[model samples]
Target chain A: MSSSLTVERHPETRPPEQRTHRQVSTLPLVAPSVIALLLWMIVPLVMTIWFSFQRYNLLNPEAREFIGFGNFTFILSDPGFWISIGITILLVVSVLVITIGLGTLLAILFDQEFPGQGIARVLAISPFFVMPTVSALIWKNMLMHPVNGLFAQITRGLGLGAIDWFANFPLLAIIIIVSWEWLPFALLILLTAIQSLDHEQLEAAHMDGAKPLALFRFVMLPHLSRAIAVVAMIETIFFLTIFAEIFVTTGGGPGLATTNLAYYIFLKALLEFDVGGASAGGLIAVILANIVAIFLMRSVARNLDT
Target chain B: MGTLEMTRKNSRKWLWAVLGWLVACLLFFPIFWMFLTSFKTEVAAVATPPQLFFQPTLENYVEIQARADYLNYAFNSVAISVGSTILALLLAVPAAYAMSFFPTKRTKGTLMWMLSTKMLPSVGVLVPVYILCRETGLLDSRIGLIIIYTLINLPIVVWMIYSFFKEVPKEILEADRMDGASTQQELRHVLLPLALPGIASTALLSIILSWNEAFWSLNLTTADAAPLTAFIASFSSPQGLFWAKLSAASTLAIAPILIFGWFSQRQLVRGLTFGAVK
Candidate 1:
């Protein structure tokens, strides 16, 4: 059914016998991957469903029994769900704002012909490749530590008080760290988009007496819309599941200040061993992510289709 | 001539360059600080005034090596990353070639669906995956990590290789086919050369993904096959920051990939932007 309705591209010059066999089997050659993926996908999903329906707790195997909707109900009543939801939304939005906002501006900036541009470009993009755990540790130990951190040293030198980033604003701290890691990726994508923009069109705008602000508003922005949308979508997908940053920084501590959905589920499964709660929470998180994804993909796909 | 206007344009360019430099520094400062701290003594690393001109030493690097068997962890990282990338490429190349050159009706949906798996929070199936690994007796092994990384990185590899293969003119393949070339010959002589850059980038991307992959590494690896991520994490304890040793460990862990990325950044930049932008 899928093969019948989809846009398939077969090599044009297969032998007559080969074509006959191809005709016999209408599905494309990529079926192996699809089948592999289906198995990989279905097995886990089925396991999750099975686990969710049964009363499953890691510590209480003998007491485990079938309790349909019981785990789901308990999950619905748990107070951490609301708190984690709120935190997840805030983390997602804040990281999105900071990364994309800074990324756009940096992309425009780096789009200029500056000295040491090679090294500067590399620096701007390096954070993207750094592992999340390393970034968190670097931020936690070297930069943001209250007593011996770079921030503390600088503040004291400048005749100011040292702020404990974790203690004062744990969620904000996590947001900053994640934004740092992802900002470069956004910058690179947007910069590529900016570079792909038509220089002649900008010159034409200038010839028409359009100022810098007018050119940016009318010319550069229109070209960047799709790039921005792509960055937003991809970044959201990653940010929605940020585990290492929270795991390393606060470990979702100080009363769950920085616990997003991913880390919350992590705590449930790994720490609390609440398999049912974690599975249901994960499913809910996936749904929440998909909502944003649908809109993001539609816009980007529209651009792609063009 | 418009000499005054030319001077104004030059001045504006200079201002923009300055702003760009400022932005670059803001972006790069943390990494710069990490490098700087790597050479400082434990006390001096945390000292006030930031100790810009301290008697630089490799004390941390020494301590870090003494603390843990660094070579063992580094070797695991190398083996696992390289091994997984090769495995992923082997599977992905055939699969991607099939899809790109011979897309079926379900191609678009299938590709999108594969990509969507990446969207699923990895932690969602962490328990099942961990349990499966344990039950299968694959936990804490290099091969185990390789299998996991290969699966995680396969979707992207397929995506990249598919796009790369698409860029190859379909007519090229037909010409080969009309000449009565076998499938193996056509692929060997035709597709490989044309898509080398893409394949190289894919390999590089996979290696980097595996190298820096921390979550599964942390959860799955214990002692023997634990990679550098866990080695760095061992420095982290409830006791708080051990600046010099942690710095040394961090630097050692990140340096190889950093250098590798620097060398391959151009290909990487293009690869990362594949289909998303220019």
Candidate 2:
């Protein structure tokens, strides 16, 4: 199975002269990016791994000493670390569910014939272009503030008390903001896939007296499976390391309510100056991300063959 | 019976059109609200029931201009985003050309390896990179941030350009070779022209990504070198009654890129999904 997958994905290796030129000429052309990426990938990573085993802190530059997994043990035993891991998983999973669910519905909605479809699409995807800091601040101050926010105004108008969004629902707020940013991406991909569906099949099914639900279950859902898988894998890779939104809005606070693994490591490394502990946390993040990366790579590789 | 079916179909179409418009407005409300609030006065911006009509003011834009050097941050943003995009294209174009036309047994592995480098979370190497920047005296320099941006974006650029190059017919290059054209001559005379539109779109996407990149820009730069991302982030701290000013700054930071993004949505899906979706 593995061999066949490989054979299916890779193009046949034609003779060098027949394709372009000798391998020597092309090898040099490809060397720079490969070499830069190799160094970029290797140098800091090796340093991170090495730092994780030492008693190093940026505050005490001269007190460095070998500690041999001491940092890992400390981080593992820390409750904050576990909380962060839990929060990371929750954030990623929640955002994925919200974005995919809303995106699929939006894709179907936009697929219908409308008078101003093009303009509507252009407006709908605008949020994806806003910078993270801008979106976070807009949500925090303009929309979600307890007193002066739009939500607050609406609640008061209806004679209900205003709820402080960040203080009360920090993680959910972050998830909502992140989901808004990414929903356009999922919609664009899924809409493309839906548009590519064979119309003749849909027509035939309709002629056979299939109901809307039945048509969707039998025809549309099956066609969208690959696109859905692609969206899930790609969004997982990004949502695992969400930073800027949390950084700008809550600072991972209300006391760690929004602190995922990435912000947790940032706090250790930059704020507290604990290089050793942060490096250990960084390695753990690498491991977690790689689990998702493997699936994404396989899916992308499969797409390359066709 | 046929007239009744027509009436039902017409009503359904109207139903869908109304639903589509509603969803579009819901999705776009935040940005539209931001744009509207930018033109309101400070008191008007936070007013209850949200002022639908007010005397528009340029006071926020004027205040931002007089108090802060908005142009300086805008310059750095344009310089870094465009500069890194060009640098990445220089490195990526040749590499993509080689991998697409010359398929060695390891080419696929190499391409995937490049992509996997992107997957490694930037936080994983934040400490070492931070220390390296400090030690090398590159902590707050534009050049330093440009280099980081170039390195981070190189993989996507190479992949996007490679996909575009793959669409170029091999027979053209083979014909050039038959005419005894050197590699440089063939690339300059033949291949580059054919692939120009794809390359342009790829470059545009890279610029958009770099422009909106907040993590590194926020972390790596302080006062002198801060881009628009960092500039907007500085507004996160509570300042007494500056909603209008903040809105103006946010609008300025996102406007150019938003225009660019709308134009390149097709390339964005192709590049972002790594050609899997398109």
Error of 2 at A301 (Å): 0.8
Clashing pairs in 1: none
Q: Score the docking of each candidate (DockQ).
A: 0.50, 0.70
Flag clash pairs in model 2. none
Runs off by more than 4 Å, candidate 2: A1-22, B179-181
Worst 10 residues of 1 chain A by lDDT: A1-10
Docking class of 1: medium
Evaluate model 1: give its TM-score: 0.92
lDDT (tens digit, per residue) of candidate 2 on A2-83: 2123222223444446555355688888989999899989999999999999999989979999999999999999999999
- Each candidate's chain A: what TM-score? 0.89, 0.93
lDDT of 1 by residue, A185-263 (tens): 8888888778878788888999999998988898988888878887887777777888877777788989978887888
**C-alpha RMSD for every candidate:** 3.8, 3.0
